[model samples]
Target: MPSGRLPVVNPWRFETNQATVQIKVGTYYSQVWTRAINAWNSKKVFTFKIVKGPAQITILPAQSNEASLIKQNFVGVAYVNHDNTKRITSVQLHLVNSLLKSNGYTTSQRVNVAEHELGHAMGLAHNPSKQSVMYKTTRYVSIQPIDVKNAKDLYSIPASQYFINLPATTSTTANKDVIANGAGDRLFKSPFETRSVQALVDPSTIY
Candidate 1:
């Protein structure tokens, strides 16, 4: 992976006041998964809530004959941060929506996707790290660290700027970002922060 940072030259923000969105669910349902998905969306918004009577479900053309893995229509869909305020369209995974419950994953997988897509609609791009919930691939059935971090970032910036965060304006010459992150000893660690080895390992980095 590239050691260089993706420039945060601009802070991310969007018009969230009275933001409106439309979620289209294709012809498939995963009641348990859908419930989980909805539950998760309810929490994504920082200042707003999913608008009451605003969430609409649409049953559209879907390739249902395919296996759950192959199914391309839906498990569920929602909007990002779309309360009575800001909005973005969100969608669930292809076919796994209904299939996950049978395999013991259940609603968690749908919850994961709902969180991720909503993350995107909220203006976050894919996080390349495997540790992230916003990673391009769905490796689990629940929210991960990346999910919380990015979501925090979504609301961190003030609404008026909507384009840049404050940190970028500071001179790195006087305020070295690498030196600061290095202070945290951000060396490689397992995706699971609570793994036994990590628990036993010393966090101090050796120069």
Candidate 2:
């Protein structure tokens, strides 16, 4: 399976098995982004749908200057937003049109960059293997077994925390009802409060 440098804290992950991505109707590079989305959806690990409204993931076109500001020589990139506890809330991906053109990338190569950025948006890190789409510098146009294995492993690991602001009375009432019913409250709730938790095997071992 693909391997990568672990973040200082556990990586954030999507709450659901499926995610919605938004692309502007007439955005430049829309074709390549569509091809990339199809490439990822071909895998069974998760499904990605395109929507016209707000979405968990948003893909946009960028200029060569914007791409360079984010990272030198980057043709595409993905960014994730997380709370203090490391739960992923949103992701944004950018594709540099000028950079791709300057690099002399063909349609297939643009798709490869899109696929790689999407992998990062889905909590995938840079894999060392050249055959994997998550490689630091992508050489593959399609997702591979290493990519699939790593993605599945990530989803298998549960969130490390759930921090919701609730009124004291309502929070207490909810907890009481949960415990009274013998539900799995102990794993994530207390009689009158909620707290962060470290659940299950380490993500590194899931693979």
lDDT of each candidate versus the true structure:
0.36, 0.59
Q: Give the runs in model 2 whose Cα sits over 4 Å from its true position.
A: 1-10, 25-28, 63-67, 158-207
Write candidate 2's Cα lDDT for 123-174 as tens digits: 6766656687765566344678777777776775554333333432213345
Model 2 residue 176 distance off true place after TM-score fit, in angstroms:
40
By lDDT, who's the top model here?
2
What is residue 23's positional error in candidate 2, in angstroms? Answer: 0.5
All candidates: CA RMSD in angstroms?
A: 14.9, 12.9
Off by over 4 Å in 1: 1-13, 17-106, 163-207
